[model samples]
Target: MMTYTREKNTQLLISLLKQHGVRYVVASPGNTNTAFIGSIQGDQYFTIFSAVDERSAAYMACGIAAETGETVVISCTGATASRNYLPGMTEAYYRKLPVIAVTSSQPIANIGHLSAQLLDRTVIPKDVAKLSVNLPIVKDNDDVWECEIKINQAILESCRHGGGPVHINLPTTFTKPFDVNKIQHARLINRVTIDDQFPLLEDKKVAIFIGSHKKMSKDVESLIDRFCEENNSVVFCDHTSAYKGKYRVHYSLVSGQEYNSIITERPDILIHFGEVTGDYYNLKIAAKEQVWRVSDDGEIRDSFRKLRYVFEMSLNSFFLNYVGHGTEINISYYETCKAKLDQVRNNIPEIPFSNIWAASQVSSKLPDHSVIHFGILNSLRSWNFFDIPDTVTSDSNVGGFGIDGNMSSLIGASLTNPEKLYFLVNGDLAFFYDLNVLGNRHVGANIRILLVNNGKGTEFRQYNHHANYFGEDTDKYIAAAGHFGNKSKSLVKCFVENLGFEYICASDKQEFLFQIDRFVTKNVQDRPMVFEIFTNSNDESCALEKMLSIDIDKKIVRKNKVKSVVGTSVISSVKKILGS
Candidate 1:
């Protein structure tokens, strides 16, 4: 048996190139290339030729590939030796020749340590190479898989999709042996965007999920509905999902249910689309084995922690082609989900007066076809449980999930539609943090702010939150309770008055209800508006707990199994639907 390179990265490189069907490798002499060269010398599958100069070897590979219509490999060691191939690689790139450059180097960590023969090749001008990435030092299976994908990506760029030269910077530990025969097969990775054909999913149980999203176009919505009906799919929507169409499952109503029951019915293929969600139940999806992220920006949003495929495409295009190519099933994943969803809708409780509770009561009062933005943490989670009208769109800056930008983001969104009423609900911490933007001249009358001034971050008071472990210590630092002084005095009253706008300050539920209708409806003056409702941190936490869990028989309990009369009815219906 012929001995091949025992090194994983070197073996990976060789196997992937072979997998891509590269027969010619023009090599220049160097000590770093010993393992790769020695391994391939015995392998008659490759047509290896030696050239003294690196530049000559590159041109030779290009000439061979261009003439034979085959991908050719150019191998060189580190330092100025690889730099000499730049001119030839540039020529090959412009001519669209399939020339792959494998530049071997000593461990990258030795770069700034004054090590001899050090060379940095991270920067390859776009004109010279289509894509350039280094094979990082492999520590585990993930690293190996990443290297395999990167190598395959390089291979794809070199030989397919308008062929061009691609650079692979290989860093070596130098002691890897050239004595193992028959390297492990490399995994091939492919990129599918809106421009390309999609991967089929006939046998897979596909689950489409939407986070906080702006209202999608009718075309996108119709395609999603048709696709769900055609496949064994379920679209999971929280209040933030914004997809109020057929086959939608509101999981937040039952997220506090049994975890096993939730995962048992969960789809193996989870397709995550839209923006960042503030749904804690959404985190349960990380349990799946594979997650396919769908985004138009070609981003790597590995939120579920099991990202296998990234479809860089719009939501409309992805589903249209996804369902168009795959086999449609007569199976019903929706009917069962719908029955349980119906039960959850009935269990919507009357929460205590707090930030979320107040918002839940009034979120419906905001006129249809308006824009609403939520502050991060509590505010986002609060509104996520309630349904927004299909015509009305909402946004939450959960991307950064910071407190300061909530008001600013809502204000910025209002600028686009100054004619529509813009409502923003946030706590005192967020309200005070962004008070400066309230005085901006650009602030318009179309904005209606539902400021839930709870005076501190009550999120710390929830036992489910990590900060709650600190108990009273949390108030001292984490919650910043009473940080900006008690809400006894009007903080933004003078500010709003100065800006030529109406300001409503509600200290109790009666005052809030009395002023809320006007706050939602009376934005006629089109001046900047702010509504401050005073709430305590305790009330906010109590309402949040009650909102997350349902009540029955006048008894409040939070658990996987709810046994109250009404709870029993809901649980019984859910279990019957699940066939449990």
Candidate 2:
């Protein structure tokens, strides 16, 4: 019997090709793609044609696809073989033909070494293929998931958005035997446009997750609000999501903890929108194959590794389709989430005076119509736990999620709306990296910066972080400690004051409380201010540990209550026996 190839990626490709309805394959003779070519040459599902020249084989595949309007796979070996497909691929690109060029090569590690038949095929001319993806030789589960998504993405791109040619660079070990009995059924992701029928989300535990988005229009907000009201749905947002609706819930407080009971009850379907999100902790509350991403880009972004459908449409149109449809109001899931959020919010412990505590103290007290931007990771995660006013808008440099451009972006936004207030909460590293922005002559008086200086990248020093294992040694290099004068008391004070700005330094709770109101309530006509609050890494780590473990502590308390009741029952029985 003819068995499948032992190579996992090759087996995956063969399975996907069969399932995606790719029947025509043009093969060129070579040793590098023997595992793939040998497995499919005898498969009854594929009509394989042999061509000695790779150049001719590519044009042949193109001709077959153009004639039948079906997807054609052109397979070739490593090095100069794939170079011959560019002309045909460019022709296919212009004509919008669905041709998938599968170029097999040796493991990428051999590329600059003295290995034969290995070429740098990682990059190619843009006009040749609409999408280019590289597939890893599968070794573990991560590799399997990566290979599956890449292959599915490449295959779908060929026929997506008016059809074009696509490239898949497959790295293979040349000596793998063809002895497997069956091929692994890889996951296939399907795309749905506005014209197609969307999946049924009625009465399901649905949740709409929005990342960093521009301020939504009232009409769009109303559409989403009605959708959640008609269907049992809630909007899970971080501070940057910019969604002011009735069903908004901050999932960050209950996330990233092991004992949060609500997290285990996964949503039936998660509808995702917008750009990058800094809330990596809250994105884990859905099962694989349960997410439906809605976007106009129509590209497959499997961020949670649970992408099952990509709805290609605008946000309003996507929601409007199901708002008045079969969806019924089921508030069980949303209420469950809100109750858990309230429990965590009401029982917040008296944490140390860290960045989190600072944000909690001032997040709700900011001016009603002001704008706020947080630094990436630690600063953003801190503010996400608290709620800002509906009229107060928030954003971050989370699109690139870098640490260097926080203040520069804030200064630029201040230039647009000179009358309104713009506040920035940034870590020391990010603030110092972009310190030159303060000296920009265009900076307005409406800007207020809260610089949390802990003398290091405190995120690396968190209790659960991998770098925390290094103890104080982590400060040597990993956290880049002692940089920029190591949180000098006079460093930032002098810098901001010299630039004709007001400087406020707070080293403890008492100092911060005294100066926070002055910084926030000051008129926009006043000089731009910088409030540099000094904190230590230990307090920052402790606050995050205490907040995330609240649900776990509740569980322990419940167990103790059960034990108390059992002890009372045992004591009553013993007393009754002694009296008798």
Candidate 3:
């Protein structure tokens, strides 16, 4: 009886290799890779070759793949063994051969600890591999998912884009005994190109989700609209998606709210495009069984953890292929989502004077042909709930999602079109961190900065945030309160005046409303402006709570809670106790 290795990563590698039909493997002998090489040495699914020299093994793979036109994998141990494979990889890179170098390594933590036979192989020469991924030893479920995706990516990259060489540096524990029989279940995500046959989505309930994208052109928007209408689907977007179509649904509005049982029909398949989405709450609620991502890079982006395929082609190609596929019956998913979103849009509660309140006041008041940039977290989340003018576009540094470069990115974008106005909604910590960019001489009069000076990192003080457990103690270190002169009224005014900026300050809603028109209506003739609004963390938290609990039926909520606790007989009693 042939048993696989007990090592999980080794098991996954062998299983996916068999699934991908990679039959030829040239392996060099070493103890670090014993668990992997030993498991597949006698397996009928693979034909393993032995080469004592790592360099000879790698070159042999190059020759075999070049002649057979098949993906060839070369395995070696840690230390200088992988170093010798670089020359062959560089040759394969130039010739465009389908060769995969699977180098087994010791734990990265062991490197710099005087451990023998351990080399720092974190990064290799760009010419050596088109893609290099480090596969960590699997110990938990997250590790398992990561390892599987990385291995699948490495295998797929070997034969993609006219074929090229790639590297997978696998770390091993070297102690698991060969005791398992069958490998664990792993998803084999196939890449679909324009030339290849796409999956039949004829009668399936489809939903297209777009992330943070640049202002889309008219052609792309028209294609998306036609595809949605013909396929009986809807397109979900956020403030940054830049997609203004008929079937567009700002899903963040309904997804962020608490009592969201009104819309329960999930899509059968989700087609994702664009980059990072700041609306993570909607993403969690929108997970489906099958997800097809479209990207020209051909990389596997398993964002929803249910990725079925990756369409490696232009966005236009994907929409063109599926536009004519129609469903027989009328699908109500789009209507359901729109009705739910409209419910919140029409019944928006009066929020406290915080970031959310500020966004509600300014989002609809922005001028046309302008651009707005938001800082991550509070600023991004607040603006996602409101609707801006269709003519106004928006963007954020959600790719990296850091607070450091929020304003710098806004300033950089202002230089692109000096005639158009550019607005930035930033938090106190972010504004102070990137204050140096405001002093840049290239800043134009079309730049407008709305500094929400809340005197702390209000994100940490949210009602449901983990940092709330510490209470006031959170401000000491986690929130870093009392920093930047504790929102000194004179500090920013003096600094911006020297930097040639007309400064404005507001402490209350009346003050903000009185001065907001001047900030919004100011054209290119005015000096660069900064409007700083002072708020508190309590109001911020309250505003967030109000926005999330907009349309809750107290009777139904209490009934469900009571049913889960006891029986339906006590539903009325629970509702009465809950004041409904």
Candidate 4:
């Protein structure tokens, strides 16, 4: 039995959410959202988090959804508050996560003229949302049932349509205090199953590309791994896999020249999941083949220019039902490729004391079943290069989102799963971008942070623009006046300490190694810790560029040698010698 009243519409909203299995809400509170916040203040069924930055709040919801495979809601006030969600919403749209944005808008009458904290909110996120509904203001008790129905429909649509984000706009006057005792047996909808199947490949080469499957069940993950092993298929995975380390998944196969070569020699069938593949061009080539995409949500469209089949089912279920445990001729090919991959892995030069090395070292030490929330920009590349531990799950808004929501997302992740060892790896610039996140220090003791401070925009030196525009003077570029160039080491320590964090900074390799080892091994009081590693901006940039150049040269020489032996050496030999 359920109860409802006119004045407690906000409470009804919370009740309806619990009924529909919403476990988390990332919200930016304001006067407009007072009623909603009051209703859910002490509720046990949901965890409501407050983020100072609404954009980060939205991404935090997306991050939660990415980990839970459930719709996470984000709430903000009208006007610019709602607008701040664009970046995260765009990411959710592309990544196909179930994020619901619950926004409060101005009254309908004052929408057009200049009203405080008001703007054109009607069609702001039309392109991104799977469904956008403007809820009618609740003035009487009779509107409760209608509002509940619409909310249910929107949630159902978000989940059923393959897990994309949705939006629900509630005007400020919509909340009328309501009684929880009056509503009885409101409504419940049964799950609807969809038919999903794929034809077996009898004599075709097959490859599997797995993206960030952050929320996939362990059983499903094992099923996929077992199927791939039995079939002698090539497997590629990103940082999100919990079993990535065990299956010998190719972490580098998604990008670079190697990816291009793999795509050029197209396989007969390709099975893809998670968001975009690392390399766009390789994906383009793979899409030309008979691609079979398996996803629980039906949101995956054949936009990569390839599609033979779309299986709308859980990846684990599909693999268990259709794939057989068989090893055939492809075993030899798989072994040969594995050998090459091994060579590449073994030949990777050891990184010195720099951001890249630090990132790699931290990734190696990451605890099993831990969540790693990374900042955007350069830190992303470092993690992408290193072999992330299977137990260390990760989430980030890699696409351009204005705010560095990495820390906020970590907060939400920790709140959702307090038992797990959660860590956030961020650059100094990113840390300052959302430093206010620490203002709301609600996260428990398990949360940790690894802050990389290179003094300035260390990543910019790798780009040609810096080289061409600023010549070889990297420090000059670093010292340039702007947002990114600011170095606030003292400020960082002060802020973290103020937030009750056990803050420590290491300026060299030995100190960093010592601090990290001590931090991970020692049993300290349960509190969040921040280890800041100070590194040289120029050295970090140089290391990556040098590695890339060496790789390019090796490929050129190898290709030219092949051409020379085959009497096709005219242009190839010249290009190789000239390093073109």
Candidate 5:
């Protein structure tokens, strides 16, 4: 029987308590305390010990803390029952034992009135407890956020930063039924804005999703890598996410839109941080999941609809505080998602010859430790299907995803490290849009550019583009074809050669393969390299359309065989009956 109630304030307290893994909740039963006691009695996550005497419950919590070297909770009703906790709280304060006394009280306005069972718990003896927090009745979102902060304050004071006893005065009503099955979500506000110190989190199902990000610092990358390893967590990444860490789920999640497999792998606590994602491609997996958004600004950017916690610190600091303390997950969530991806990969047929197919073939050719930047739309979306070496970090301008800055971004990344090779796999339109960067003096011999020229915005030839409905006219005005007067080699070759680059152009797969090996080699021809591979626009769109249905058709074919067998069995049975 699921017996947790719908009281907002109590829900916030319990949600946070579960998050911190507060196991034992000692309850002293009374009329005012029924709201908390009745709700918790049905939940198996908490171990409830009944001690009718309020004073006895407090002393028992102290004894439990002393013996176990763990924080223990004491729950009681309002009135003189709170006074009974003074002696035990003082002992816990002096002994530095971590004991939390949560006393349920009537509303503050009801205290001075002639209302029964009301007491002003606002002012408790300072020395009796390390700290006392009166949690308000959470009616609005603001109240809800405040309620969680106070609960966290009590939680932190009780067990962390030199352990000691703390008091929480919970104000709640007594009418709601104890019928809620799952614990409600609560906002866990961390006050450590600038400090590296983080609070320990106790949730088991932790997920870190990285959207578009800058190249992470080595220290931050190392910390993220270690945190994922220790917690057995997964980092969901795409081509634009730009995070290359261990335990990376480096699959194009946009490809999984049809399967809804992403939704199946939802986490109990999702930690998402990075810039905006290009794959709004139904990331609705996090729709109702607990998310803690980590950012420097610490502002409320609730991308995930079910955001409960906002840690206003660096991703590293937020990760450091939550990694080691409470992750004891037995199942591999990473393996679960990986297995689904592997199954889909096994069904993936020989990709049709197009920009994607060509990119896949040469993706493995990029040198180790090289930085690869992708253009927006077609280029970023296609290369995402292939795997890159972890030593290589890749990114795209998904923040304001536009074709105009792809080459410029590549040049900027190249300037970061002159000795290490920097690379770009871009579409013709994007390259031409940012063509001025090619002549820039900052272009170094270590730079490699793979311009996948589909003649125009071939993406506009596909289903999603508005121009697809405009007929052949899309070839001119929409697809923006016939650029450089459709003479691809003459214009691009002359331009690159004039810009002091080793220009290599391929019109066919065989031609591309013959030169791809040499093109990717260290400092090809000692100048900045441009390998422009030309393809038909239709081929580019068809290849993408083919990939989307690759697994869908395979699954349908398997099920159709079962249907055929069932039909044959029925026909044979009918023929036998007719003969009889």
Candidate 6:
């Protein structure tokens, strides 16, 4: 039981959050959140952490949510503070994490005018939060019960419905101190069972398309695997795929002509879980079918594409109850897909110093229980190609491309999980974009950064326009791509030193491999450690081309206006692909 009176609503709110099992709160202190902060300052139920920038605070909350599998709240003042959370909110929305944003604003009377730190309090970040509620200020003692009810509803909606973010806008007047003994805790509602029945499949050719699933509950994965095995289905898991089992999983192997032929001959049923259907080609194929989707939230749209069935329940729960007793079907399609996948993996050309190899090697060296925060870009792609250890957990919001919020997110994650060793793997461009994040003086020594600097956007170089735009001159091309040219190494060293980090550089394959152990095992000196690895831009371009050329079964090809597929001209194609 929590008491609520004038001047103590904020304390009551914190107590309610603790009761609901919120372990952490990432906040940026202001007069508005002072009472809330003070309430949790020495309390044992939750750890209250601060970030100078609200954007970082939100992302930090995102990381905490990803790790703890619990709702993480972010607190900030109004106006720009709310706006700062937009990028992280977008990321959280797509990734499907429960990040509660508690924003403080001016009183209702002061709103709509030129009040400081006041904005449109009603408009929530669309699609970002499952529920957005504006709590009424406790102007009189009589309003406390209503406020308590709203808070309870907000918490339940945020966690129960799809497990995404929620927003609770608290006006300044509600920050008043109150007695903690008078407030009664709201009774939690019973979990609702989804009554919808899955369509019966009578000896139909069905396939399970597994997308980027992260931190799936064990029960969910086991049920899904049993369902697939019983149905004699093929599962196509993407790079970020999380579920693992000894089922007849296939489909990702079929690429190029084989993939096109299989999709043209559509299966009787297609079931999808998580985000994306592996790649563009798979998505295009799935779009043609009367698909069935099982998700926690109703936000899983068919992209205006109609679905045969939509089960809005936890995938694990749905499968365990409905799919466990289904009869097993035998099909030759599974064998064909597995054969194709084997060929693709076997034929993938070995590249000495490509991003894929780099990712695989680095991941291999990471210590147990290391939390990895990778930037969105080629760095993410590289990690996607490799298998991350079970001990290593990452926030899979790489969907927020070109938004340099991961650095701040990593810093905040390190703060929250202080005992765990953390690593941030980012491209040079991503590092440059969020350089301000390094300004934090409280960064822990356990945080290590591996900056894979290929001079410029090596991922962009895979297109054709880049080569055409830069011509044959290497210097001109590097400069056009925003590389520091010969000064890249110096710049990195200077930047690391300025941030009080121990810096080391590796320019070639031998040096990179040689210094990796030192980079991974070396202790940080009161700040984060940075390992700058240098490689040729052309090498990355060539490696991607080789990967694309492999005769896989499910290769998705986008028809560009300009078609050129020669090894030498691949660089031009890369530039064109990246729109460089």
Question: Per-residue alpha-carbon lDDT of model 4 for 1-580, expressed as tens digits?
Answer: 3334334445456666777888788879786765566556655667888899997898888888888898898888866898889999888888888888888777657887878787776776565788887766666645665565557666766786577888887766644553455333334322323453346666666777665555767677677666656665666555543345334444452243321244433567777777643323234336334667777774434434345455667676677774564644234435655665565556667665676777767777777777777776567656666676665677766444433678887887788876777788787777777777777858677778888877666666654335435744654655332354455567778877888888888887789877887555423346788888877666676656543432344666686677767766577677799999
Predicted structure 5: lDDT: 0.76
Model 3 misplaced regions, further than 4 Å = 78-90, 114-120, 123-127, 175-177, 258-265, 326-331, 415-419, 436-445, 494-504, 522-528, 551-580
Give the per-residue lDDT of model 2 (tens digit) for 400-449.
88898999999999899989999999999998899898999998899999
Better of 1 and 4 by TM-score: 1
What's the residue-level lDDT of 358 in candidate 5?
78
Give the better candidate number (3 or 5) by TM-score.
3
User: How do these models rank on TM-score, best leading?
Assistant: 2, 3, 1, 5, 4, 6
Predicted candidate 5 versus true structure: per-residue lDDT over 466-517, tens digit per residue:
7799867899787898885473577888888998888888888789889988
Q: Comparing 1 and 6 by lDDT, which wins? A: 1
Model 5 residue 393 lDDT? 78
Off by over 4 Å in 5: 1-204, 253-260, 280-284, 326-331, 553-580
- Give each model's whole-structure lDDT: 0.76, 0.87, 0.87, 0.66, 0.76, 0.66
lDDT of 6 by residue, 251-329 (tens): 4324323323555335666776677432433454463445667677744344214344556777766677646565655
What are the root-mean-square deviations of the candidates from the true structure over C-alphas?
7.5, 7.6, 5.6, 19.1, 12.8, 18.7
State in Å the error of residue 206, model 3: 1.8
Q: Write the per-residue lDDT of candidate 3 for residues 1-580, one digit (tens) a residue.
A: 7877778888888888888889999999897888788888878888888999988988999899989999998999987999999889999999999899988988888889988999988878989998898887888989888988998998898998899999988888887667777877677788999889888886587888898887688888998878877777888888888898788887787777666553364688888888999987678555457889999887788888888889999888989997755645343777888887887888888888998999989998998888999999899999998888888889989998889998899989999999999999999999999999998999999999999999999999999799989999999999999999898999999999999999998998999999989889836756889999999999999999888888787876785686788986687777799999
Candidate 4 weakest lDDT stretch, 10 residues: 183-192
Residue 234 lDDT in model 6?
65
lDDT of 1: 0.76
Q: Model 2, stretches more than 4 Å misplaced?
A: 326-328, 553-580
> How displaced is residue 149 in candidate 5, in Å?
19
